[model samples]
Every structure is written in structure tokens, then in C-alpha cells.
Target: MCLCCFLDDGPGSLREGCRRREPLWIVFEVSGTINLVSQLSVSSYKTIDGRGQRIKVAGKGLRLKECEHVIVCNLEFEGGRGHDIDGIQIKPNSRHIWIDRCSLRDYDDGLIDITRQSTDITVSRCYFAQHDKTMLIGADASHVGDRCIRVTIHHCFFNGTRQRHPRLRFGKVHLYNNYTRNWGIYAICASVEAQIYSQCNIYEAGQKKKTFEFYTEKAADREGSSSGFIRSEGDVLLKGAQPCLLQGVGENCVFRPSEYYPTWTLESPLDSLKDILQICTGWQAVPRPAEMLIVA
Candidate 1:
């Protein structure tokens, strides 16, 4: 089943009439801005596909609060502003999600936040630019339930951002074949027992900022196990950037490989990431004809 959010020449409201929110496809028609008045709460078993047209969202962005089997593809989330607003927020036990081929800007607070026990999420082939604090996985240290947050961030382009390409916490994450350039503070942050496995990622940092940093409150304690650790396996590190390991979990920590994530579509990198992000990231536009067509 499918429902169409047809629009006129100007802006349209996503909540004006689109109500049956579950087990259907919401196909957007026409190209304009959908000025979101509030957080667009997505329902389960639904796919909001924004393909073939140029659509923009203002104010608040999409919020997947405890929803399952959702796919948001080929949309542009730009110029979102508010208190702690994100381009996409996957929260509170949501699972089996895929976010692909979307262009995201600063959007004020951040780009995407996957937190609160959300597992089996894939944020792949997306373009993130003109933003600071790009992505955040796992809610916080206090939310120990975030240990179940398993995420895969692959083949995404993070360019000209300040930090938090993702700052993680207490989750098993797989990051592979991504591109990052001109970061402000840090690229990947580890906090609160989070384990990050970075492979074949290109990390380029500026003069002031560091490439990667791991934060643990127990650094002073130096006890049995550290809270956060970043295991760098054959990644491209440039410009005085170094992967800071936690106290106890140094370069010899247990290898938590990419096997933790379930099966999904992935492109394996054969050494060079020269063109992996060219056609994968951002809004994938369909080409138009050179000449016009006349109808009788």
C-alpha cells in the first residue's frame, strides 16, 4: 500500500492529511520545501521515499521514536534549527533501519542521533557537510541500556565538519570505507565503554583539531577495564592525527570485528577510496532530457 503526499507549487505540510502512518509507503510528489512544524514521528513498517524531486525540510526533522523497518532515502535535510534538533533521531529501541543517499547539513544541533537501545541500524552512503557534531550514537553513559545499540556507518562522506562524525557510547559499531576531511576537534569519539572498529577510513584533520580521541571517566582509576576504546585497523591517518586508546584497552584490546552487525548491502573497498563516495552519497538525482516534449 502507498500514500502520496502530493504538493502544489509552494511548501506542503507532511501532517496535513497523511495520517495512516504504518505499513505503507509515503511517496512524495512535486518539489519544494516541507517546513516541518514539529518532529515528524515515523510509524513502523513505513518507508518515506523522496526520490526524483528536490525536497527540503525546514525547522525540525524526522524522528523515529521506537519505530521498526523504516527506510528514509534520497532526501535533503537542511537548515534545521532548534534546541537539540537533529536531521534524524532514532530513539528508544528502534531496530532494522536504513538511511541512505541523503544530504544533511548542520541542522543546528546535529545531523543524526541513534540512541536508546536502537540496534541493527545502517547509515550508509550519506553526505554530511557544513555541519558540526555530525552524528551521535548511544544516548549517554547514564543510559546503560544503550549497550544494545549496534550501528554500521559505511561509505559515508563527512566533509568540513567540526566533530562527532560520530561520538559513540557503549555500543558495538562497525565503521568502514568512509571519508572524512577538515575536522575541527575530532573525527570519532569513544565514551562510556563504547567499542569502535574503524577500517579503511580516511581521516584528515586541521591544525588545531585531533583525528580521534577516546574519553573515559575511569582513566584516573586505571582499573580492570576501560570505558571507551578505538581499535584502528589499517586506517588512513593524516595531519598529526592519532587514535587515542583508553588506559586498559590499548592497542591489544579484544577485536570486536564487523561480525556484530547483521547482513546488509555493503560495498567492499579494494585499497583506494577514490570514488566510493562519488555516486553513493547525497541526493541521487535522475537525469533530465536535453529537449522538451510537446503533447497534443
Candidate 2:
């Protein structure tokens, strides 16, 4: 399945090609920026590959609804602004997903959202900038099903983005080896009994940026005692930055993310993360397909 130069199969458009094809690898043959008026609804067992060339999808983005075994990489999503629209929308039924080396920003909604039972997802090596409400792991406050949502965000660059770098509601989130430069409002928000483990990250908060650690959303309708639990270790906050941990979140929960699942363990410290993550984040080093050659 190749989406080359906005070519569509029929009346449905590029979005339909994604749904009609199964267990397929979609590659972009066209280079440079292309405009999109509609979103591409991704299906299961699909990989959107944007290697070897710069493929930019603007005006709208992609959505993963009840999808599995999906991989999206090396694509740029820009100028996405509308209600219920985002760079990528992952619903509860999405699972076994990997989104890597993508540039997502300036969306009307969140850059990425995993909610309503979405689990087993990994977002890595992506660059996020010029957006507010960047990410939302769990969409709403009342969805008890969110307790099943689990995510891993590593080696990504959160640059000058506003809050929800992501705000979690339930389940365990492991965020490590990430660089956040100049945040807005609060970075790393955990609301409504969420368990967050943050480690080995670099936070360079700007003059107006507030709070690098976990913060609980204090709303009128929420219980005063229901707060998220966050265990932070080996993080570096630069000048004009202050770290704060709010009270009353994940009151009775545990902070050992590795305990929930053995593989979630993070061995890298902050010192080494700064060196490695410097070249990993953004679209700096996109993984080429196996057949592509590398020059020294």
C-alpha cells in the first residue's frame, strides 16, 4: 500500500486505502509536504513507513481506532487543528503499537492520546513543539477502565510545549530519558489515582514554565484524596526551574513501575541519558528499512 502523491483508490480516499488493506506496509513514494483534508483511519497489522524521504502530512492527521499491531514512523504531522482531531488518536482498543521518530505539533487537540483501554503502546524518539495540551494518556476522569492503560515514553524531545506532556489518569506510565525544554503550566500531570514513574530526564524550564515533577489536578468534582503517585529519580532541572511534587495522588499505590512489569525497569541514569538522548530525539535519526544502505 503506497500513498504516493495523494493518490486514492476511489471515492473513499487515502483513508479508505488504509482500512481496505490488511497486514500491509504503506510507504510514501512522494517527497516533500502534502496537504490532507481528511484523516487516515489506520487498521490493524499496518505500518506507515516514511523512510528515505521527507513526508509531511498537514491539515489533518491519522487516527487509530481499535487497532493492533500498528507502527507509524518518520512522518511529520502539522497544522492539525479541529475538535476531536489530533496528530494521532488512539482509542481503548488499540494495542501493540509503536510510534517512533515522528514530528507532531500544533494540533487543535492533543498530539497523542491513549485512552479508553488503550494499552501496550510505546512512543519514542519523537519531537513535540508549539502545542498546548500535548498529550493525554487517559482522556477523562471517570473512566475506571483507564486503569488498564499502560504506556512508555522515552527518548523524546518535548520542546516548548504546554502542559499534559502527558497527564495520566490510571495505570502505570514509565517516562524516562526524555528532554523537556521550556514547558508551560505543569509538566507530568497525574490525576485520579494514576501511577507515574519518571527517571533520567532533563528538564530545562523557562522563565514562565512551572513545575517539572508530578502534579495532581485539583478540580471541584474530584475527590480531595484521590491523587496520582509519582516516583522521580535522577532528573536534572536547569536554571529558572523548580521541581514540585503535589500531594494526595496515588495515595495507596506503589511507585515501582518495574514491579508492575519486569521489563519496564530503567537502568540508565540522568548523566548518560543526556548524551544518548541528544541524538535520539526528534526526527534526527530515523530508522531506515533493512535494504537501505548507510554511508560512513
Candidate 3:
């Protein structure tokens, strides 16, 4: 079912309409702005598809307060100069959620934040610019334990005007092919048992201070192939500059140069080793054991 409404009419009207149906889809087609003085909470199985009409939610976009199966797509959230006004926040115990093709900017806390028992989430093809905190996965992790898991972030662009760090805590996160440019301490930081598998990700540092830093008190037991990690000239590693650990069949996978042209194949050890050397000067290349190269 499809329900379209104007924000000027009032959120109470939208709330009443949502109560009538259990798990319905709402579409907003108005090409204007709406001021939400308070937070907007969505019920379970509710999908808000904006259809590129620019439904500017003024307050916090959708606070999923213990609600599950929520989908927010193609929407733009404007926080309107407020602190802690996150674009979309999935509260504790929220599960099986998807946020795609959304543009979130200009807030104190973050563009999209998931915390407190949220799991199995996918955030793809979103844009975040000019915010204090761009994206945070499981900020309030102390209370939530290791509840946030299986988070997949792909094809997203994050450009921040202020110096802020994008952090992930105590969860298994997969960050793939995302473009991050300008601002902040670390493009990504994981603490505790949070294992991050990142690949083909580009980190373009703005002409400010540093580029990236990742730290964990206990050594991070991570596994992945990260080729073509491009950083600005001013990028520096602060602590524990160790090459990302790879396991299983990935142990034998040699790093490859980022081939921009179609017909060029990267040469074996030299080109691949140069790519790794460009990123981390301390990285060492050695012969892989025969058993480690065997793939089942």
C-alpha cells in the first residue's frame, strides 16, 4: 500500500495514518521541506520511499524505537542546526533493516547511527557531507554489548567539513568499495573483537592534518584482501603499523595493482609489492608457505 503526505500538515496526521495499518509502505512525493520539532518514530515493517522528491525531515529522521524490519530509501534528512540530530537511528534490539540511496548531512552526532542490539543491517549507496560525525556503527556499545553485527557498508560516499572520526565498536563489520574524502582522524576504527573486512576502499584525505589511524588494545584478528587503498600524500600511521592479516585461501592472494585501464594485467610480485609499499612502508613481502597457498 502507498500513502503520501505533506509535512506541513503535521506529524500527528502521519502518526494516525500509520496506526491504522500494520506494516505498510509510505511514499512521500512532495518536493518541499518539513519541520519536525521532535523525533519521528516509525513502526515495524514500514518503508518510507521518497522517490527523489526531497522529503526533508527536519528533526531526527526516523527513530526506530525497538521496531524491526524498517526500510528507508531515497530520502534526504536535514537536521536544521541541532545537536545529536541523527538522520536515522536504529535503537536497541532492532533487526533486519536496510537503508539505501539516502542523503544525510549537517548534524552533530552522525548521518546514520546503529546502536543497542541492532543486527543484520545493510547501508548502501548513501551520501554524507558536512556533518560532525559522518557514520557511526554501535556508538553506545558499552550498554549494548556486542549486539551490532553483520553490518555491510558498500558504495557510500562520506565527505565531512569538520574533523571527525568514523568509529565502529565491538561488531563484525564489512566495509567495501566506499569512497571517503576529507576531514577526521581515522577513516575507520574498530575496538574490541570487532573484525573489519575491507576491500578496494578509497581514502582521499583533504589538505588538513592526517589521513587514517586504526587501533585496538588487543591485537585485531582481522582477515581480508585490501587492494588499491589510495591515500593523500600527507597520510601517516600513528601506531601499530602492521599489515592487515589474511587467513585461509586469502593467505596466498598477492596484492595487485589497481588497474585503471581495461587491457592491463598487473605483474606478479613487483607491481603488487609496490602497491603495498606505497601505502605502508613497513610492510614486508615474503614467500608464502606451500600449504597456505593450497585452496580447497
Output the number of the TM-score-best candidate.
2
My TM-score estimates for the predictions, one after another, are 0.83, 0.85, 0.68
Encode model 2's per-residue lDDT on 175-251: one tens digit a residue.
Answer: 88788877878778777777777777787887665654454554335556476777666766776667655323353
* Candidate 2 segments whose C-alpha is farther than 4 A from its true place: 7-14, 212-225, 244-252, 260-279, 284-287, 290-296
Instruction: Estimate, for each residue in 108-129, the C-alpha lDDT of model 1 and write its tens digit.
Output: 8889999988988988889999
Q: Best to worst by lDDT, what's the order? A: 2, 1, 3
Cα miss at 266, model 3 (Å)?
Answer: 18
- Higher-ranked by lDDT: 1 or 3: 1
Q: lDDT values of the candidates?
A: 0.74, 0.75, 0.55
Candidate 2: lDDT of 199?
A: 77
Candidate 3 Cα misplacement greater than 4 A, ranges: 1-4, 8-14, 17-21, 80-83, 161-165, 208-212, 215-296
Per-residue alpha-carbon lDDT of candidate 3 for residues 1-296, written as tens digits (9 for 90 to 100): 43345553444344444444486666543455656666667778887666635556665456777777888777677664466667787777788898877777776576778777787788876777777666676564344354345576766666554432356666656555555656655566555444555554555565543443444433224353212121222122222322233322242222221221133222222334324423322111222233322211
Clashing pairs in 3: 92-116
Q: Best to worst by TM-score, what's the order?
A: 2, 1, 3
